[model samples]
Target: MASLSLPQVDFRAAAAEGAADARLREAVRNNTLRKQEGREARWTELPDAQALRELAARIKQHTLENLDYYLRQLVDAVRRNGGVVHFAADAEQARQIVLEIAQQTGCRRIIKSKSMATEEIELTPHLERAGLDVVETDLGEFIIQVSHDRPSHLVAPIIHKDRRSIARVFSEYFHAPYNDDPPALTQQARLFLRDKFRRSEMGITGGNFLVAQTGQVCVVENEGNARQSLTTPRVLVSLVGIEKLVPRMSDLAVMVKLLARSSTGQIMTVYTNIFGSPRQNGERDGPQEFHLILLDNGRSQILGDPEYREVLRCIRCGACLNVCPVFRSIGGHAYNSVYPGPIGALLSPLMFGLERYKDLPQATSLCGACGEACPVKIDIPRLLISLRRDMVNRRLSGKLERLIYRLWAWGLQSRFLYRVIGALQRWDLRRRADADGWIARLPKLAAGWTAQRDMPAAARRSFHNIWKDRH
Candidate 1:
């Protein structure tokens, strides 16, 4: 593996190019099975998976319904535990709040765990621009950060690349000869980041679930980067989306059980820690200061909307990405947002508005792979159809498409005209047929269709036409 310097545009372009055709479908088909089989084996090995999912679903529903009460309870609990609480209406406010804390503490270099909420706010860019050094401690995130790249996968940011690529990125960032082997690559990153961990001024992380019952923050990860990040510094900040709040500490068991099986197919992640407030006096090692910023950008909007409220049930599991045909091909960047799969598609529109994401909704084949793959089972396809309908009703669709659909409706309304048109189309195809039973290509608007596909040579007799004749 050579040093793969990941330029953002190039990375996004490669992903966008791959998703245009069959190769995108093939890529997802391959990875999806690996993840699905792994999950099935893990779940089958433990009889607790289905029960956990049902329990987790109920817990999420309960929290969502009484979110106001639970969020207030979570805040009080955190305060009781001596953790400061910050409310951010959107990303900028969240970033500003974090930066203000860092400045107030006179902190410069900060270490962080993998947190999608932090990613949603893009904490690194904000902190770096403010003259602070922020290092990602998670192995996958470390690979991406060192390469200066955006994460392609939610769980495994480097899933699109192999060990060879990992070695290359490490070699370049660490300025040492790195091996392409897995163990060697892992060792190099471990050694290089260890020093950063021990010298950090502050640490930041995202919470998996915030227990309202005990005002505890929970995180699950294969690597101990999150643990290190949360414990290494004087000021520890945990950024959690408002939707991550769960009503009770007991509910944590159910969600955690479902998390691993639905995600990487493990009975449990290698590390699961519940932190209650900052470390107390005589504690061996932990942060001296703690803060939890609960962000509610567009989440509150979803809560108010009847049609899109279920979007909150997302547990940040990447199952939808593995089973998504569109995501596999284009990866996440093509949507031009943080989220890049079925979940991303839904969130991007809501967060950024659908008008800006013109190509996203139409990118799907209307297949229900995403919904089927989801652990909580979000109805993605139905939402997509609803968005399309909304787009059309808003007159956001192209005029030509509206005309075509109207003409199609009118033609189909009269059986006599429909048969006459079908008969003419078949006659035209017969007249144009040449040697080899092929017409090579068709004309104008129809040419694009036949360019990659031979539009079923207008069967000598149409299905409806033949049915009538036989009767």
Candidate 2:
């Protein structure tokens, strides 16, 4: 088994660094805003977008409620179709299972599609350590692989990167003249990967949804890389989270309707591959051996808790990330988790613990954009608030922070203290104002406010004072 231990995450530092990068901020903001606009445009084409989202949420909720039963059914169905199913208790177990399969099948070369689940388990390095040649076939993933960079977005892996950066990477890798053309870069990669695909003996993928009724793994993609990953190799392995189950194929219809629209604003992805089992007697293509590894990895603990279980309904479409004010300011890597943005804020704390990822919940502005943007309606802001309350209950908050909040609460409950605090706050703010009336700096606790934007000085007269004078 490979080591899964991770060092302490400094989310605040990473977020601050990302926020300070003007070029990175511009790239991420422009891409996400365009996707958001496309989503809104696509939503208008639907008869009842909200109703469809509700239906999709209900389907996921139903599957989660009866997960055990669905799991049994899914396993049996896969077996009936000549496919194998394996249960992994965590990331270590999941990696071990794939390694064992690789060893048994005598596979040396592997091709992998873009799967966040595989990334979540950190499978690639373990395989590389085992001396197997593994290549990321997805164009974005390929860039990330060669450049030694992590994905910054769910759908668009290299959202933080510009054409210049990519061209530099490609030029260095291919040892060719600098070319920033999109088609040329894509051709350079495609020509390089075409040979790898031909030689790869095994394929790896992540599922968007698992249809329990027919034991099919449905993977959606704009590019055809996932299709090749499924059909080009003799042995196929799919690593999917346990929470990805959908009870019926009809339910998959409801999910598919919202998935692409919510993700990149397409009516449907260019390729939506739904497959089960290995190739049958007359099949010329497709894998001869298939294995599905269902990963738990702290999900069972999350499922057992009612307050946070609804988050399991997420389809990972990343609509929330696109519309997130905080994510727009600071890209995905700042979250310091395989998942990022509003969803990552909830998941990291819930799956890992509040102690390691306490700053994640505070990353959001609680603007409710994530909740409204979610296709599955996960209510991310509500979950974030719940996590914050949990943090306070667990004494994860600092002593001074708790004291300040307590004092603030106490002052709010008393009229005299409220007025006194308000007067003092106004005076202090006014005193800090520069000649132009913009406060460029703030005192201790509120200093971060002026770090990016200047604050305006409070008005000399209050509304209450004006009303009293008029009366």
Candidate 3:
């Protein structure tokens, strides 16, 4: 099989275009703010929310440290429970593993719940290429699939789209009557998917947490579609990242509390399903064959790196994305990766390589909002800084940027040069400033920063100059 091409994202270009879409901006802004507010309200009501977050972080840290042991225990537990497990080293291997299973089982129609792992591997396209019909059951994912679009948010895939847009998509594609109301659209989608669920021969899902002790895969979702997908099909396949393992079943409470509240601001999701193995004798409804594919896909490399291992602690809550200014402005598609936002900025480059995803690390302002919003307390801004440092050390940054930074560092080290540059900057700013002391446009290298917004002129005198005079 040919290698999958990495998404070529011109972040500057995509962001410029995305910023122009008022409708998309409005939807993203409204949804993100609402989720943030809801999360804050619910988080505050919980006594010792900070302590819970800390505990969750500690548990994740401990699990990651002993990941190999936990993974072995999980695999053994799964086998003991009558479920088969497969290890995939990369996306291609993962795709092949699933394809082989589908071909062996003669599965034509497959139902999939919302799974970022499946998205990460680009499994649906691979399965479709082999002549299988795939349907996404999540309401948001279903809308995105029908519209031939990618998910714009982690939890809410269609966060960039409004109800009116969805209604149009339904009318255009499904030939359904136009209705913009939420209930009517939901009902229409539910009716359409119910048939697919019943007919699907296989089901694919992503596990939120893999329990080592009980060998169970936990999936949390607001919709019941995941439950249906897992139980309705004859064959079930779960593709989960290696980092998703937890030490035991008891740890789920801490993660559950963090995940739901952090992602959707719900005290508890509508459904939290834990599946161990296929249906045994006398058991009904579950799949006949249960397959768990533990995907590495560069995650093991991350696990080895102490600086970035905390990234694995992320519960996919999307709280960081909600608080991210860059994500809010550009949206997920502009990141040009399956994962987006602050977490994506860090993970994409780490998994895909810094050279291929060089621009991703620079996509942030290092505002630290992502770190603050993160339930597991992954220091996203710090990770971003580390990626940038790696880029600089590898000389991946452009010559001009490296040169400018070298000069900046040199200037900062020398008091005389710093004062000279500061004075020159103030003089230049004063020259360009209008009567209102606002520079609407800047020249050359600085123009991009000023293009979108005005830059305030520098003060008439430097703080150093004023301090020197007063002394």
Candidate 4:
């Protein structure tokens, strides 16, 4: 198999061109709105939604505060259950550990469930580099894998692609008959991946929640593909973020209730599999070996930061993505990270670097919809603002922006300067206004704002001036 290039982070280019496609915009808009409606309908049906949310948040906060205790307990529990646990401080170590496991097991072909953790580590490329064929079993993930594209949404990876686009991709890649029917497309993928599953020596997946009390990993998915990936193979490898741990099995109830409803708006996902360990003595079907890797990959740093620790409380429900106006307009690709949307804007910068992902914080409209929609009640807008402040404090912002802000602050501090500036703005507006009283073009720094939009000219007279005269 040929090696495929994974997506790179180029927010500037993606925002400029990748998001300009009308079809892509329409598809994202339509799909996200549908999910939002479904979420609203299902969310309203719950009697104590707010209470559940608060409970979930508190549970997460408690777990995070004592993460070390829970993680050690979790490791001991997994070992007692005859499962192996590995801790990776970064992505390189995580990938190397998985590779070592595969080589030791002599596993060649691998089947992977939908795992953002794996994506974060670029696992597929690493495995493929070692001459292993790794297949993504989820339908959405499969589409993205075959098309050589990154996921545009968390729950629905290929939400940006319409049926026609998928059909085209299938026809071109698989040489299958040209059909836009949903079931047909699904069947085609099923038939293609069945052989891979049967031949796969190992199955890789991401855990939704790690139950520390039972040492069990809970995976939630709408499709049975994850089940097949974990069970059909001889070895099962689960890669989970360190933040996914919950205190007890009973706590899963609150998370499970909020997760499904907030994500796809289902009463419950099709499969919520919990695996404590490999196949037991009496078990008929299960992996012979179970390996759980707890990945830190910048999460520990984020956890240490008081202001951003709330970000780890995310359930990966994608509700925030569905409600974010910026996400709706530009889609996930614009963020250019494994995670996208409001949560992505917060997580990517913290996980990666503030300097590299500076634009992510600026992408929001500060509408607070993401915070309102979050099942765990993370204040996403507050985090975005905090990140912006950090940028300014670090002097990461450009000189021009600093100068402009300083000038505006100075003008506001002096009443005479404020009035003079206002008068100058009115004079400029009068000079620049066209017949329609619109500024079609702006000079220098402000030109970018008017590139795709018209700026309304200022009012003919200031309200203060008119009020003063009338009095």
What CA root-mean-square deviation does each model show from the true structure? 4.5, 2.0, 1.8, 2.8
Kindly give the stretch of ten consecutive residues in candidate 4 with the minimal lDDT sum. Answer: 1-10
For 147-218, candidate 3 gives per-residue lDDT tens digits of 989897889889988889999999887787888999999989989999999898999999999999999999
Per-residue lDDT for 1-471 in model 2, tens only?
Answer: 122355676888898899999999999999999999989999989999889988888899989999999999999999999999999998999999999999999999999999988988888888898899999999999999989898888888999999999999999999999999999999999999999999989999999999999999999997798998899999999999999999998999999999999999999999999997899999999999999999998899889988889999988889999999899998999988778889989887787777888999987789999999999989899999999999899999999999999999999999889888888888888888987788988877888898778999987767766788986
TM-score of each: 0.90, 0.96, 0.96, 0.95
Q: How does model 4 fare in lDDT?
A: 0.90
lDDT of 3: 0.90
lDDT of 4 by residue, 139-222 (tens): 999999889888988899998889998999999988877999999998899999999988889999999999999999999998
Q: Give the better candidate number (3 or 4) by TM-score.
A: 3
lDDT of each: 0.80, 0.91, 0.90, 0.90
Which stretches in model 3 have alpha-carbon errors above 4 Å? 1-6
* Candidate whose TM-score is highest: 3
